[model samples]
Target: MWGRLWCLLLSVLTATAVPGPSPRRPSRELDATPRMTIPYEELSGTRHFKGPAQNYSTLLLEEASARLLVGARGALFSLNARDIGDGAHKEIHWEASPEMQSKCHQKGKNNQTECFNHVRLLQRLNATHLYACGTHAFQPLCAAIDAEAFTLPTSFEEGKEKCPYDPARGFTGLIIDGGLYTATRYEFRSIPDIRRSRHPHSLRTEEAPMHWLNDAEFVFSILVRESEASAVGDDDKVYYFFTERAAEEGSASFAQSRSSHRVARVARVCKGDLGGRKILQKKWTSFLKARLICHIPQYETLRGVCSLDADTSARTHFYAAFTLTTQWKTLEASAICRYDLTEVQAVFAGPYMEYQDGVRRWGRYEGGVPEPRPGSCITDSLRSQGYNSSQDLPSLVLDFVKLHPLMARPVVPTRGRPLLLKRSVRYTHLTGTPVTTPAGPTYDLLFLSTADGWIHKAVVLGSGMHIIEETQVFKKPQSVENLVISPKQHSLYVGAPSGVIQLPLSSCSRYRSCYDCILARDPCCGWDPSTHACMETTTATANRTALIQDIERGNRGCEGNRDTGPPPPPMKTRTVLRGDDVLLPCDQPSNLARASWRLNGSVGLSDGQGGYRVGVDGLLVTDTQPEHSGSYECFAEENGLRTLLTSYSLVGWPEPGPAKVPSASDPSVSSPGQLVLLRGRACRSRWPQCHRPLHGPCAGWS
Candidate 1:
């Protein structure tokens, strides 16, 4: 049966493969051809293919293995680069069955009702191993998809302990050195009562058992050191960025006033002691205390943090992204701050060394400096003032200055300051770029995902210098919580609302790799002996609109209707008005809610009542006067929503006058016989000659 299935799949692939240019078209020859400079028409003979219609929430790329992992709305697909572009990429090597059934199925429950597992984060451990986390599937899991057999290996392990809560909040994953680490939404007991807890705290904790992941606390974000030796030494640390209520404060106290709410924190655990069978026994040491600072206190909601290499010269320097609500601007904006881990450690230790009175040293112990607070290290005095322990307090220090010991005093230089980079919009989470410089200068690139479905790429050009790039990868607006990049393949994997998109660095103009080679027709396009494959350049024709259209077509098939004519015309309306009552007539059907009534373009009637009552009978004006003899527009609003407005002018006044009486004889004239006749003395002349005619008498009467 398996052999027959394999044969059927092969036959399907062969039938789909049509004769055309080879899938691996030479980039050099394609670039050499004269291309149109026009914005819309640039390529020729382009072939387009659509992947499965599933909406992906996360994307992961494995460079060493040359594989792309796309995590969609409820299913997962592994696609090869050779089968991605053109019509030839119709092959889907593997796919996770759509999670349609309820986790714990019961009788009478619909099994195919789509219990979607929205995959949010993906981390590549090695060439074959892959780790992924999803919402429906609350457990942390790792799977090895066989490259040759196109089947997932039976290596699923439940990560329920690490990711204890639903992923609706946010989560991120990083593969530092050998062990896989993830920063996920965790539930923990509130601080005051050890037995009964109310509110959950967002705390940074390691994957180890009892220490951080215990029922007492939850982790917000985690970072693992990439170096093997560093992974084992003091340098090999896992930093957790989270927000938790102060240990001493109660819920009522913190909740009474918004300012006393939960504060941001960082905790670190040494990697050396984290990976053994006794993992749960290890304890996490406190590193730094950071609070959400914003001008508007109410808008501040502690989300999550991302750690990035501050300067290219050293990997030890790190920066963090935090979300805060402030009145100074919109609540949706996010603020970021930079802190040297070494300096954070010092501040965490308090002003212990500063108040060196000799008699009683604050931080000094009888045994000698009680294990220099976990995150503290001695630095210049100016750098120390930048730390803010209060939630509403903003850091006074603008930037950090590196001082030289050779000088008599601390030399503060503004050129190389380490500070947090600010962004206009708020982002729920941030992911550090995976590029690390061991021997020479390091390149700092940080990826941030916004709540409005955008991926922001930030690169530290130098000390206190940065560049930001934003790209829209999702059609519908959905929150982008996590992001990951594969340095080996130079591809950016973004986790968005529906699914993931693999953005090749070659597509970015800054990289100057494939795009530049393609434009210049250089030898950079051919296959390289090292990778034994053609240089991959994503054609511009592969766009969201095309993909959406293909998906829609596949779903609708040939019976789909096509629009061939212009839209219908708008409806017409008429208005009528009386003394104080106005009638508005609408001819078109509508679903509008609220209608606005404007009188002579001056006073307008809305939800507020002034001198008018509006209803289905039209607008009713209580008192009628001559002054009100102007154009009165009556607007009808069903609900609070806006609707079509129509108006009529009552430009006349009521007057008193005699009433008209009808006549039966002469319909046109009434009471015409009421005229009085007078006879004048001149009529005496006419009396003698009445038969002669009344001309003389009429002359006298005239």
Candidate 2:
């Protein structure tokens, strides 16, 4: 719900944001929300008198103990990730004091989830400790809690710059080596600041406009990365992803009256760049950033927070979710894009964006380069080149770094095309685990959450994607706030306005037949010939090298399950009066078939005799006669290939005897060409004089 409200609130900024470069044409040729037969089981979490909205604040997952730590208004609860069934885990109360709660209420915040001290931040500090922060009634406070004991220590750490004063404030932080790197608003939430705490002379980047950040919306992730290519003495770095307004461009090509436009961006800071000796002392000198290009083809920039995940390798591959926006700042479609961490580094190594007065444009630097490039890793080679430390950099280079912190190159996705695209649906979160078939082939099985409280499971095979299923997570239409998977990746934890539900990632048993099971292409499942059903063959405890090795992705050997042995017995006949139409039942599942009717046995039924009309429901024989009795068969086809479905036979009722006969020559009798009416049936059986079609008082028969 918070994610939805944020989308609506962004409309207020539409009238002010200036439009930028046109978006690229989206390369996705097909988009779909595949209806899946996948199943899920919902479990309950800790509930309170104030209701479940409190549980919607923050959810952090720890895999070792299968414990999910939830931070809410004045409370901290832990639920077992495997199943949050009734009374699964007890909640630990850590709300603000009575005075703080009342103070927040007096400040005009809602008394329920807002006015109370909401635990807004939670990060793993160590094996036994968890660092957390709460919006203490509009005043931020931080504390270290004992994870094993579930108790807060006596010492309350100062939370300034670490936790936001409001629950909805744009904030992001990462913990490494007992230190916190945070990017948030400072000086009463007006100026954006990036800071590093937990050390002497803590390094803090200068305020926004003075640095790189602008009016950013939200932060997705704070990734700590180390490159194998790093030279000796290079420290790992911390990177942040968010959407910020473009820096002021006084280029002559564009209009000066244009409003500020939002751009997806990535900024990073070195872990060892303590500070400058005099100029930027106690500040980060290695702070640098670049633009991230993630617009929908033919659409504008991407907006809002997306789930950030990575695949392991030499250079990590990041898979992120994004919603496309128009020039007007309204969100319309969603896409999932992949990025390599190596790309981010490449952009940082490029030129800095600087204003060129002579050319009247912001272009690549034509000026002399620094001995050691600004923001470059402090490797031994770079250090030997007269750049012993950040302090040794000349004022000209530092000034250029300060004035133009943006990179010349923009970060592009690894693949030119997005893996999945959804039009008219907001895809909020995405998380995937790599699955290896027994045959040693690997693929990504993605689980994406929608704005309408549904989760979609899809697998990308070759150039095509199969949407396995769409399962409802929330009972009502509430947006998924956050999603996380258990350590083993078998269980999914979805956060909603209600409570978190632990859903099994794969439902192998739901696929009853071998055809459906093999067609699933789910890495966790395989069709077992002995059991004749889908089974969870991929397991952490078992050697899956063989179980998933020869994956039947082509769905081979499923023909035996199709029952091609013989056609069903001839259908039973239905009695109908002469001159009456026949109704045949052609049963099938909804939208799963296109029925084609054919005359199996000819009793001389055709257009010249009396053919059939196909209605939205079933097949209808136009006219019925004793000679019209024949076999009518229906076949269904899906994707491809046609199969016999059902059949029906029509047998006409014998003509009545002389005393009870209905005269066909009677003017009141209905003809076979006329519509069947209940009155006509009665006239034919009881009122023999009016048995014929009711033409002009039955004068012809008279």
Candidate 3:
């Protein structure tokens, strides 16, 4: 009897053991850095709007009105979308009452940060007004704002299920027709829920022993109108993306299970899902969720999601940014995966997963599923079978749905892998824009924002993605909270903790030469033979026929003829005192190429042990001597072709006037020669215009 008891105990322990974490593999898809990095200070035409408080988290773009609405802590702002830097923005201050702050403090919350109002949800209610909600001193509240006046009344609606009580938690909502569908934690209860409000009969997830949403953190929600694109007259669906704890029985407790393994999920509910008359009253009857598989072993967590909807349903795609969760936050790598709408729909139509009561485990249901499908919308075929709405469904169907809300299959990403992968970078948000080239092909450009205040722009190709460039939007490290792309305005509005910044859609003029323009693989940029400049295709309407673009094969499209080999090298004269340090700027246009400095027609100054060293932005020459003076040229080599970027004539002079240096305390004592010398030493990276014909053609360099 003791041997039998020991065997039973061993079996139970073996069954309860959880699997270990998946092994990490090196990513070879994309580089961590982009081809070019432009600092925030070096960026031109960038607009900014500082928020009144912290957490500038939400943004709404009104394209028709040419305005952008920002929702921040204790305030809201309205800026001119075209030019936000004009400093003529409108503001409205909305803070919590003193009583609410006192109550929040009594409840053990921080009075300074947690007691203030934080706007979390902003949705368009009508043509003239917007529905906004905020965390009001740990009490959720919402109100309507007049678009023209940009003001709100004192009255508010209780926003328990519409918004999160804690500003730190994640929540998402979408307003379809007149109803608001939201995924958030129940106010003051901390229970994760998905519910629909503002309807005839409000519906919420079931409060059963099997929690439908297990410690979920919402990411994004969208409405997909299936009726418009379907021949079966299907009801519209509202889809939500989030990460939640997996439902697996183990030796760990409930709290440990929640923090142990997380699974990214995509759930959908019918827009017309009325409560069942007999079984599931005031609850969702047609709700089903599936795993969003991005990689093997499913170890990544969803960070952000964006959709690229096309005219056809088959062409529509959704891109998601996920980070490896097994490692620490700073060491995590991000993966970008693309999912087609059809694949997601197919998974929803597959088998269901059910929990076994006797075994206390979850697995694919072996029993026969109810007729007409449990989690199916009211399609034309279902209507023919005596099911007009969800309330008319049979009790057996509702009972099946209540027991099985998970799908047996998961929605795998396109190509069975991530499209782009980068280690040591955590992408917080992303947006996509489609650009049509002059060559009659369209390409999608993805803008990925990192937690470290950088935005990487990449173009999608047939096999993978190629990063065009990166721009530092903020001086300090901060996560990009929201991003929106406006093709009509030709700009990208980024929302962060600091403020909102407006960046141009394409910086084509930054590329100096035809070779650089063609090699960039930017779909929005093309070389114009008429003007001999790189110009944006949208604004280059004068000479469309003379435009050249080659995204697939790099610079091979510009082989036959060009204005000249390369631009005439811009030569500058620099004079520095002996023994003083000197810096020669040699900004490389392309990251794929190698840059080196050639002094006096030879490459001897780049040895690391000597005073000369090559840096990313320029070459630094320490302890400058008279022998260091020479004609220096910076060359970028790519595909065995050397291109001259810049040329500088360095001249060292003997110290004059008793070797007296300029003193910081004596501003008036500064001299013109000293000013010129300071200006020469302060090297700046800029695109040298080819319009100046000061030097001959760069024949050997090209």
Instruction: Determine the backbone clash count of candidate 1.
Output: 22
Judged by lDDT, which candidate is best? 3
- Position 599, candidate 3: lDDT: 83
Using TM-score, rank the candidates from best to worst. Answer: 3, 2, 1
Tens digits of per-residue lDDT for model 1 on 312-353?
A: 213454445555443334323454444455544343434222
- Candidate 3 to truth, TM: 0.82
Q: State model 2's lDDT.
A: 0.62
lDDT of 3 by residue, 409-506 (tens): 87887766667767667899999988888878888899999988899998888646888888998888788989999888899999887788899988
lDDT of 1 at 399: 8
lDDT of each: 0.37, 0.62, 0.77
Which stretches in model 2 have alpha-carbon errors above 4 Å?
1-28, 35-53, 186-188, 227-234, 248-260, 297-315, 327-331, 356-362, 383-396, 462-465, 487-489, 540-702
Q: Show the lowest summed lDDT stretch of 10 residues, model 2.
A: 693-702
Cα lDDT of model 2 by residue, 1-702, tens digit: 545643543332222222432225323343555735333343223222223445555788888787888877677877766666646676767777888788878878877766666676788998789989887777788888998888888879777668777676667777777878777774354656778887665888765336456776556655554644544766677777777766635343223432465667778888767677766777788888776765342233443333233322243655666776554454466766666777777788877787667866456666776756777657777677777767777776666666677778778765444555566668877666667666577776778888888888777664445677777765567877677766374777777666666777787776565545555567777666554556776653344432321233434545655432125446645555666554454543223346666775433232323445554344555445666576777665433435565666656666464223334343434344222222223422432232233321122221
lDDT of 3 at 355: 87
Task: State in Å the error of residue 440, model 1.
Answer: 12
After TM-score superposition, the amount by which residue 638's alpha carbon in candidate 2 deviates from its true location, in angstroms, is 4.9
TM-score of each candidate structure, all chains considered together: 0.45, 0.76, 0.82
Q: Write out the backbone clash pairs for model 3.
A: none
Report lDDT (Cα) of residue 313, candidate 2.
Answer: 25
